[model samples]
Target: MLAVNYTTLRENMKTYMDKITDDYETVIVTRKDNKNVVMLSEEAYNNIMENIHVLGNKSNYDWLMESKAQLENGMASAHELSEAETDE
Candidate 1:
């Protein structure tokens, strides 16, 4: 995460934006009167939203937890993909 004041961010907008997109970094643009806003790449934002949607569902979350526990307990098996499946 990076933080810069509003005026500073405005002065170097391109550089900051490039850093955010290229490095997948988040920035906080601070303003007067505690009006702060965050900046992030669209890809990052979409990934976050996707995670929220997946984790927010009770059934999905439970299934994920169960899978994790199974893996931790060595109750999972590994299978090799066939040539056709790998091609897909």
Candidate 2:
């Protein structure tokens, strides 16, 4: 995470934007009156939204927890994928 004032961010917009996209960094742009904004890559934003959607659903969250518990308890099985499946 990086924090910079609005003037500094504007001065080096390309540098900061490149860093954010290349390194998957989150940047906070500070402003007056306690108004601030965050900058992140589109890929990062999508991943965050996807996680929120998955975890926000009660049934999906419960299913994931159950799967995790089964894996932790060694109740999971492993199977090799066939070549046809892998091709897809």
TM-score of each: 0.90, 0.87
Question: What would the per-residue lDDT of candidate 2 be over residues 1-88, giving only the tens digit for each residue?
Answer: 9999999999999999999999999999999998999999999999999999999999999999999999999999989987655554
The whole-model C-alpha lDDT of candidate 1 against the native structure comes to 0.97
Candidate 2: the clashing residue pairs are: none
Query: Candidate 1: worst 10 consecutive residues by lDDT?
Result: 79-88
Q: Compute the lDDT for candidate 2.
A: 0.97
Give the clashing residue pairs of candidate 1, or none.
none
The positional error of residue 57 in candidate 1, measured at the CA in angstroms, is: 1.0
Q: Best TM-score goes to which candidate?
A: 1
Stretches of candidate 1 off by over 4 Å are 85-88
Model 2 stretches with alpha carbons more than 4 Å out: 85-88
Error of 1 at 50 (Å): 0.5
